[model samples]
Target: MRADARKNHDHLLAVAGTAIAEQGVDVSLRDVARRADVGLATLLRHFPTREALLDALLRTRFDELTARAGELETSSPSEDALVSWLRDCVACAHEYRGVTALMAAALEDAESALHASCVAMRAAGARLLTRAQAAGTARTDIDGTDLFALVAALAWLSDQTSLAPRADHLFDVVAGAILTSAGNSATGTTAPRPRP
Candidate 1:
């Protein structure tokens, strides 16, 4: 890319990140272009599609989660690291109102521009998950895919206005299910009890 083109790309990404953070991921592409003082054609040239734009915008956060998982492997206990990473994934998914949907779709579509990033993110979680399971702390039957689904579900549930306030509690419930230790088992005393 030319110097001017690279400048525009950087400007657009900066502006779009701010826009999405304030407005939402669904903010118009044209709005992003206008905000960046670039043309729609230019934005399209750089991002191609909404998902591509989102993928770029969220790339840093995704990479951070991946890196955190690796750090956690050495810094925290096996089960603690896995649950902590799952919480981080949920937080990332909820960064934008609609990010979880985009992530969920990207996970299944290899053609998606975000697919590679999504795969990397899951692989990081898988490493932590495998460590936990090997330690007999997490369920052995579940894999990274299941972890992704659980994160997605947590993200979605966190978005529901009616249930949003209790989402953290729900996350703890599910996390307990994922654990298989003496006290942390799904039916154990640490599990969240259902409301009458």
Candidate 2:
């Protein structure tokens, strides 16, 4: 793509991503185009279908998130890094209210881009888990699948009006199960739980 075209594409994706997060999957191409200050024809040229557009935006978000997790993977205190990544993941998940719904709808259709992105995300997440587990701070029983479920729940809670503000509480509850530091329990702060 030309430089201007690429800029337009990036701008459209950013606008659409935020719109979808705030307005749910029903947001119109017109709104995205308007936010990006681009014409409808340009938006259509970039994304032929709403589902296709959503899939692209979802992948883009996941890609950025994966990079962020990877960047922090080697940080000291593996447990902190993992928990931090989990918190960030929830933020990324909430960027769109019905993101999980969109993924579900698209995943049902085999050979879809959504399916491909899901696979990629799973692998990336697993790698992070492996690193944390290697550091002997994460529970052996808990795997990437478990983490995925946690993120799903967090995202769902984030989409809810009543649960949104307390979303961090939900994450704290889940993190309480994973972090470990019984020795520092004296401080009375929510210390990490035992890994074993």
Candidate 3:
């Protein structure tokens, strides 16, 4: 891509990220174009479809979360790393309203633009979960898919006006359920401490 075109693409993605953060993943393409001070055609040239645009905007965040999981895997205790990564995943999903549904759908749809990124992010969390389970800190009954579902569920709870206040409390409850007594002791609590 030429320098000018790359600039436009970056600008459009930046604008789109803000728009999606303020409004939702369902925000209109025209609105994003208008916000970026670009023609719809220009935006389309960079991102052929809404999914493409979203893929570009969210892929970076997904990659970051994946990398973060890897870092935590070696630096933190197995249970701490899993809980921290779980919290971060939920927070990322909740950052852009309505993204949780898209992520969940994309995870199952191989053809979806976001599928690869979502899969990578899920795998990162799964590794953390596996490590915890191996350490006897997490439940063996659940798998990576279950952890992914819990993230979506926790994020969905934050999106609900009535349940938003209880989301944190519910997260603790779910975390406690996932951890064994030994895992709970490792974290110094049944509900692991919040990430700093």
Instruction: Name the top lDDT candidate.
Output: 3
Candidate 1 segments exceeding 4 Å error:
1-8, 21-24, 37-42, 182-196
lDDT of 2 by residue, 2-88 (tens): 998888888888899888877988998899889888788989999988877987788877777777677777654566667777777
lDDT of 3: 0.90
Per-residue C-alpha lDDT of model 3 across residues 53-123, encoded as one tens digit per residue: 99998999999999999999999999999999999999999998899999989998999988999999999
lDDT of 1 by residue, 1-196 (tens): 9998888878898998888766767999999999989789999999999878888778778889999999999998888888889999998887666787778788889998778888999999999999988887787778999999999999889878899999988898889888875427432426422222
- By lDDT: ranked, best first: 3, 1, 2
Which ranges of candidate 2 are over 4 A from the true structure?
104-110, 181-196
Candidate lDDT (C-alpha), each:
0.84, 0.73, 0.90
**In model 1, what lDDT does residue 48 have?**
95
Would you give me the overall lDDT of model 2?
0.73
Question: Which has the higher lDDT value, candidate number 1 or candidate number 2?
Answer: 1
Better of 1 and 3 by TM-score: 3
In model 2, the number of clashes is 5
Give the clashing pairs for model 2: 21-96, 179-192, 179-193, 180-192, 180-193
Structural similarity to truth (TM-score) of each candidate? 0.82, 0.82, 0.91
| Model 2: residue 163 alpha-carbon error in angstroms | 1.6
